[model samples]
Target: MNRNRAKWLTLMTLVLLTLTMSAQNKQKFKVVLDPGHGGKDTGTNHLKNVEKDIVLAVALEVGKILNKESDIEVFYTRSKDVFVPVKERSVMANEAKGNVFVSIHCNGVASSSPSGTETYVMGLSKNKSNLEVAKQENSVILMEDDYKTQYAGFNPSAPESIIGLMLIQEDYVQQSIDLASRVQDGFTYDLKRKNRGVKQGPFWVLHGAFMPSILIELGFVSNKEEGAYLSSSKGQKELAKSIAQGIISYKNAYYNNGIAHTETNVNEPQANTKSAVKGVTFKIQIAASSRVLALKPQNFKGLSNVTMEKGKKINKYFYSETSDYTEAKQRLAEAKAKGHSSSFIVAYKNGKQIPLEEALK
Candidate 1:
């Protein structure tokens, strides 16, 4: 009787282990693609070059390209010409547990001079043009029912109102910038579009997402030449291909060989001993998630000194802290070696994050 019971227990344990491993193997990288402005919202219409139709077409094409990859799963906020509330788009991405959220849009103005691609990550910026873009996109809240209550009295025209939204994205800002940069690079090198460079703006759609998010302005629809190209099938396909390739590049860098790069490691402390800089602290950001993990070596793959910054919806995890810039780079390399391939050095001065360049100086 004892031998039979032991055999049964062994069989059940092996079966459970196999199931867990299979589930892990089947995990796919999710990409949430949001096609900006649909249904009642025509977006920026310039001489019949409708923004809604163009963005939707391009987004669908991009999703189709990405869906071809076996390891990537794509989700669309709206698959057709339907109105989707701005906030709901983000809620969908969060619910899907998306690795990244991309909102596709087109720029327009009364004047037809500006004609280039601009990719934006959520943040507070003083740039007037960037703020205007945010305001234009955020104005869609007005189309939703009970806009004032839904958005908590967010006034799109008043840029100051967006300052509160910026905090929601603070944890993922670095990752968002990396993704945005890749997208902008694709537009510049692959499509030969004018490089407007990656900029920071308080985009409501991007801020509400827990993961890295970007808002892409494909090009100015107001320009006659650009509008004609954007509306054509050939041009849309080319743009979609570039955008897909950019996402693939980002995924390849961060995801690496079918394994998600976010897995933490518990290893010997990697911060090098070096001379300290006055009023400067450097930390390597390893990961950020909605999960609040205990600061334990066991939790972080045996790494000690792992700290987390808790936020309302997201938390940021970091490894090692030093005042030496060179040591910070060394720590960053160690983190990448430990499988945090997307990790980057974050510098601080007097409790505030500042540019690494300024911190070094």
Candidate 2:
């Protein structure tokens, strides 16, 4: 116990010193923007308009704006329409040491009446409708031939999908969710578009990211009105700019004290070192709930990480996931700095991932 305590203390000290050093050094922030579905992989084709083309235009425009305004370096998964695999997107961002990733897509639905803008982060969708959206976006992985192996075994029917999902950098989930919400909310409030609120679901493309990430569904192409708007270059530009502003908001919140980069202090004994197993203690409470089911992504996307369970028999909302409150505070701040809205607390019980509430007091 003494040795472990000493180790954790060393880690904490290192983290403090590193934070000071990072504040002193102004590293160029890096972001990865993925324009979803390219090449033969045309996404959401409707009314002679394609989701791929629309997102590409928006991404390029957003990149241009970001380059002009900030010293932050941004990279695209693909510069033009080409077959880039889903998992490769996160790999590219991580390899580049990207602080944040934004995926752009235009939504589609069988019903033309469904028109709205929504954004997404990685997690299992409790909503069947959200599951379907995830299915549409994730289906792209099948095109890659070895997606199952490449993406670390994304089995659709497994009860273990939750554990697998949590394995994708438990650190970044909160921030990603928040950033997605901000973008979706900003678009609806500023652009006066339909608000298809934020919902969680697993996407193969989002896994393996070391930083906060989000997938933006610009609008539904199946909806004639939305398809036309998304098809317009002006509309795409507007959408992209709004999303960029949301990222900027997340950055400002995180970097308020002048810290940068995602690396935890290696000098610290416990900082970034893997946590060990034990039952967790959760003083969980529902914090917020929508009076109406959030169909608008912006409405719900800005919400930080907490479990959302709306199973068949019950619907309980407004709960906090607190595996470790102290560490959660620090990580949450770090996440915001990395362009996420919030951060999450990932508790390890016996060296295995477990929900905070499941842990014993």
Candidate 3:
């Protein structure tokens, strides 16, 4: 009997250990890092500094920094000088179950005078410059072996082709914009680099990512000074540090209830919550799904006061409602703490959902 008891105790201890390990693994956040353009696609070679090489160095450094974090699992699309198709890069991220996707690239222009760091979230845009950037990046598909079949008649040069592309990423637009804004802040405030601000553009690389994604234009490689700085060892380290900090800041805000533990300088501005709608009412949007889910708290991690609204192609679920903006922000925090990482405060006017900026104004 004594021997049997001892054996049972040992088995229970092993089971507990295994359970703990499994829980910790479940908590790990995966980040997919794509070092844009490689091999035959050198990407914007200018004044002896290649966009592909600079971005690869920066991406590797970012991965190194993120790897130091215990909860972050970093996956690189191509660690070495190897070409990866845009769609395949997204496929790798999806297979890895990445929480976020970041594609690193250097921008180039004809004049060589423009120099700044801009991040882009996938969207259809009418802006001439944004479209041009998208066109240039999307044009890389032509280099693929079976480009025609791979892209399915999508022409990079045609604006109409972009319109025909599926907008599956629209649900994550706000989250992507939030991260892009943080990255821009890191570049402008911490690194003292020019900030071109976050913008939306239809980039094929960002199109297929299921999670929040952004394409970072590190700096204009066409500019002589910027190109040299981007190519330098010191610049690469600093840029990597800034981008890493931004990622950490975003992770802290969304995943950890805004508790920051990283040492890098990251100053994320408070999300504007002021509303113009009189008798202002707010809600916390917890999830956006392609399929409509039943309005039950159990369906949303035991989140109470759940509501759903049907959109053209997707449905959005919101949790908690309040008249006070401060209370609404608190509710948003609670939703995030409950594993709704992308939850954001939404304002309503006369029972109709309105844009946050419009409500604010």
Top candidate (lDDT): 1
**Per-model C-alpha lDDT, please?**
0.83, 0.67, 0.81
TM-score winner: 1
What candidate 1 gets wrong by more than 4 Å, as runs, is: 164-166, 256-259, 263-330, 333-342, 345-361
TM-score of each: 0.75, 0.66, 0.72
State the lDDT at 240 in candidate 2.
80
Quote the positional error of residue 322 for candidate 2 in Å.
18
Candidate 1 at 226: error in angstroms?
A: 0.8
Q: Candidate 2 deviates by what RMSD?
A: 13.1
TM-score, candidate number 1:
0.75
lDDT of 3 at 259: 31
RMSD of each: 9.6, 13.1, 9.2
Error of 1 at 187 (Å): 0.7
Report the candidate with higher TM-score, 2 versus 3: 3
For candidate 2, write residues 1-361 as lDDT tens digits: 9999999999999999999887656565677999999998997888888988899999998888777654467899998979898878888998988878888888887778888887777765556676677778877876778877875776644434533565464456656765776788789899999887776666767767888888888888888888999999789888988988887766654442234423221112245533432355322222222223443324444444435435232222322444555554464454445444333333345544443323322
